[model samples]
Target: MTISLRSRHRWFSALQQLAQSIPYPLRGLLLGLLLWSTLTSAWINPDPVWQAFAPESAIAALGKLLFNGTLWPHIGASLQRVAVGLLAAIAVGVPVGLLFGLVPMIERSASGALQFIRMISPLSWMPIAVMAFGIGDLPVYFLLAIAAVWPILLSTSSGTAAVNHKLLLLARSLCATRSETIRRIVIPAIVPQILVGVRLAIGTIWIVLVPAEMLGVSSGLGYFILDTRDRIAYNELTAVLLAIGIIGCALDWSLQFLQKYWQPSR
Candidate 1:
């Protein structure tokens, strides 16, 4: 009995050491395996709701959709909308954010109004957006832009406010002109913050893009989702959901790469 106890202790110690030695990526893979196993079991269970598409069937449908050339165009269309909307948001939000940061009075006066508007759901404007801009990409663009702008604006404003006061004072002491101080010191200081904001905006815009695309746009992942639903293609719908998760993860990783590249030391 003592020998058996010693043997069990040794085994547990070895297992613990093995777990600790495993790299992070391997750990993540193990977790993924566990999650996949659970999902597979759930899919196999006798549930009518889940019977719509099992994990294996969803994988097969995704492969079929990919090979049949039914997926790429919608992905491209969604990406295009995201690009255009994000650009517009950056263009408008950055300058406004700068102004808010630089001028205390403007920030104070605008704070309440901006917060009120910001609190309103972007989707709630759907009817007004459709009425004002009409059907198609215009309304979708409006929604995406609105969804993205707040993050950029807030981040830029906060970054600007957080700039080193000593540097500003030094510029003044050196008799630097307002424009020169801002051009050299302020802009550079705020750039990292702006990039952070843009990263956040991209995430918000991507999430909003799908639902916006469903609103009369002929080509986009959202439209594809609706199409699959109407056609009773549950597997295709699941495939699209998987595609969205994969693509979203990729975009987030790309943004993280850019953020690290921009602020390497920070």
Candidate 2:
């Protein structure tokens, strides 16, 4: 038993050391290569998803058109919708999270309804949102807000509830006001956990951004993809697919950077 325990300890230590040693940019490059390989594999042999890597000139020309000619409009439109929806979700979710997590009775009251509602996908809300909010940006915003809200809410609540009992007592002993204790002690202590939720929310937003843009939105990566396919510009489509992936990865990387900075002190 002692030998087995020691071996496990050594193994865990080695893994920790290795994880710390791996540089972020190299890791990102490797991940990008993996993504490219997976996506282009069929094309290497003649697959529909990939027509060809093709000539650099043709690909470059198509890419140039995609960038300056038509793609920008679509991308801009989608980004705006994603930004608006996510910000709205954060506005609503964080406050609700604080309420539930701090008040057990409130949490209990909300638990059943929240769980039931969350099981329904944001996409599932599409028909209703479209009807209620109308065809354009509203529907897209509705979907994104639905998709991103849950993680932030759950994380904030958990973080707030998980506040150290000793810290709570310390605050009490200091005769801190309710608002002051929450502002200083609770918010700071829970920030790391909340940051984790924010990271998750960013990832979800990225994935849903295109899909959300699909709901009759005139511009965005999703709209561009559909338009490219409709025009049968397969190579350009592939390039744009690659570009979208790159953008998504960059967004995730930025979130990770922010998360590291946002990490709460123990």
Among all candidates shown, the one with the greatest TM-score: 1
* Candidate 2: worst-modelled 10 consecutive residues by lDDT: 49-58
For candidate 2, write residues 1-266 as lDDT tens digits: 99999999999999999977989988887787666666566645465545354334235745786667666666677668777887988998888999988898999987999999999877888889888998788888888888889999999999999999898899999999899999989989888777777778878877877767777877778888788779888777766776777677877787778777774664
1-266, model 1: which lDDT tens digit per residue?
Answer: 99999999999999999999999977997797567646656645666556456667677888888899999999899999999999999998999998999997999999999999999988888999999999999999999999999999999899888889999999999999989988888888888888888889988888888889988989999999999999998889988987887888888889888777785233
Candidate 2 C-alpha error for residue 94, in Å = 0.8
Positional deviation of residue 199's Cα in model 2 after best superposition, in angstroms: 1.1
- Candidate 2 lands at a TM-score of 0.79
Q: How close is candidate 1 to the true structure, as a TM-score?
A: 0.85
lDDT of each: 0.88, 0.79
Residue pairs in steric clash, candidate 2? 74-219, 74-220
TM-score for each of the candidates: 0.85, 0.79
